[model samples]
Target: MADGETPIFPALGAMAPDFDMPASRGRQVSLASMRGRPFILYFYPKANTPGCTTEACGFQEALAALGGTGIPVIGVSRDPMKAIESFADKQGLDFPLASDVTGAVTESYGVWGEKRLYGRTYMGIERATFLIDAEGRLVRAWRNVKVPGHVAEVMQAARAAA
Candidate 1:
């Protein structure tokens, strides 16, 4: 680890950083292109991992409610498109899954930071989600998230915000 690199967190109510990254659907998705529609932006550690798959499936199961609240879900991970595509197909996840190969987007969102495993420290994406309003403001956020019932909370937040 660097001697003086401090961690950062995303500020509440701030506009999320605009990003253009590859999606599992064989195209690039930019936040700006999704203007006028609210979205649920979530970042997971990796694709096909147990927790990440559960989170993705949870969102998949709640798509109707999410969409009903006029919010669409987007999952992000530092995986290649091939891996993401397989994960989506295996989990039946309809939400768009973006690949942040360069990790720039994740770092910008403050999700990529120091992580620990068995007393070893490293850098990785922290499970997180942000509910963005149509005007591009952060309406709600969950950082270092727990997988269980997280999507449901997001759905509720979306409805309440709407």
Candidate 2:
């Protein structure tokens, strides 16, 4: 990836990028730990912001259904562990919310890149979601995700994949 060039989402069927980061509940999440279990890994720009909050809550609401399929959802951001923990508590989210303070995980996932908002350009995490199968292969990806009805779509895809 060149400077100022947009990062491309990892090719489908490719192994998802590896990650190991501190998360809410004083837990550490990594791709290796999640092997043999399909899971959802989503990246949002900031913690506790409106869109992020909505997305987190939506996943929380669908936890039971998701868990029924033995799939866990993990949210990732560049926010520090403290902020990520606070957001998880405030949102009543039981799933892991990992902090990628060094930006490596986000960059590896192709979610960290140039972002434009309110006519201002900046570098940040793009709102994105990826569903990885039990084998750690990327099964589905949603970039530039819109919050409304997104979880339902994920749920449907998860059912099919599981």
Candidate 3:
């Protein structure tokens, strides 16, 4: 989970919570609206940073292939819509980069919490991802993720679920 705390929910096969939040592209995405389509929901700490950028770009490079199979990847972050838009545009990310400005959505997913850096501690969203199947139940989850190869793994998981 986000602040290194154990996730506040049950494991896979549980119904993911229904949430509607502003996306980087200006539309709202909700679990209820996505019931019949599989999606990968990834939560990141920030936009345009090293790890976050690498993760987003990795998805950008494989978007066509993943979409060709009909699974959508949605990236969420604490940044505002403006920041997400700029990051998506500058990186040519074709996927939806959702915005969780209030961090409510992040907390709902158990991806927000207390984090410490250099002995300093604060609350922030933890970098994580969830693979929600067509039924809106989680098929897989990755917490406190490292960017490299994460996209490819999510793609594989999505394909398997599909």
For each candidate, what is the lDDT? 0.86, 0.94, 0.86
The reply for model 3, stretches above 4 Å from the true place, is 1-7
Highest lDDT scorer: 2
Q: Which is better, 2 or 3, measured by TM-score?
A: 2
Clash total of candidate 2: 0
lDDT of 3: 0.86
> Which one wins by TM-score: 1 or 2?
2
Stretches off by above 4 angstroms in model 2 are 1-7
Ranking by lDDT: 2, 1, 3
Backbone clash pairs in model 3 (N, Cα, C under 3 Å; residues 3+ apart or in different chains), count: 1
TM-score of 1: 0.92
Q: Per-residue CA lDDT of candidate 1, range 21-116, in tens?
A: 888767678889778988889999989999998889899889887777777888999998899999988888877899999999998888998999
lDDT of 2 by residue, 9-118 (tens): 68899999999999999999999999999999999989989999999999999999998999999999999998998899998899999999999999899888898889
lDDT of 2: 0.94
TM-score against native, each model: 0.92, 0.95, 0.90
lDDT at position 150, candidate 1: 87
